[model samples]
Target: MEKTFLELISENQSILFKICNVYFREKVDKEDYHQELIIQLWKAFPDFKNTAKFSTWMYRVCINAAIDILRKDKKEIKKLVFQKSTYIIYLIMGLSPLEIRKDCLN
Candidate 1:
């Protein structure tokens, strides 16, 4: 199974690189996303029925994985920014951490 996957990926490796290039600007991000695409493809291999071309299946899997990663990162960044802004507001309001927690619950 591994050998077959390797051969197919080797032939279409450029597809993964192309998708990564389209999504990421930094070299490290591209490389990391490339690995993520490969892992996603491997995990989804069992579902491949050979009804469609390997490249087609690979493109779908890689694109979805890339989008998911971006969405997760965006969520984390937004959360961090919100926390920082909340802390600043709390400080200006002279609220303690416990008060901040209670306010958040409310």
Candidate 2:
């Protein structure tokens, strides 16, 4: 069971990271979110009957955890949004102008 959970985590680690990135702006906050996610996943794994794709189940769990965290830290929502916007701008700046224009159109 431990090995199975480890394999699932290895395969979906990026999903958890992406969720953390989306929900928490500060590096420290993101790390906290990641740790929280790992703990939640560890606790929830035993009940997972494999009724669906593990990634799908994991994503649902991640989103729920993120939302719960946000609700608990309501005052930080604005800060998180601003930071996420800044990150997006930075990501766009790193892209080629052509890519940026394409992204804008989409």
Question: Which candidate achieves the best lDDT against the true structure?
Answer: 1
TM-scores of all models?
0.81, 0.67
After superposition, candidate 1 runs with Cα above 4 Å error: 91-106
Q: After superposition, how far is residue 54 of candidate 2 from its true place, in Å?
A: 0.4
lDDT of 1 by residue, 1-47 (tens): 99999999999999999999998889999999899889999999989
Q: Which digits, one per residue and each the tens of the lDDT, describe model 2 over residues 1-106?
A: 8998989999989999999888899999999889999889889888787789999999998899889888879868777898678557957679765675676578
Q: Which runs of model 2 end up more than 4 angstroms from their true locations?
A: 75-106
lDDT of each: 0.93, 0.87
Candidate 2: residue 92 lDDT (0-100): 64
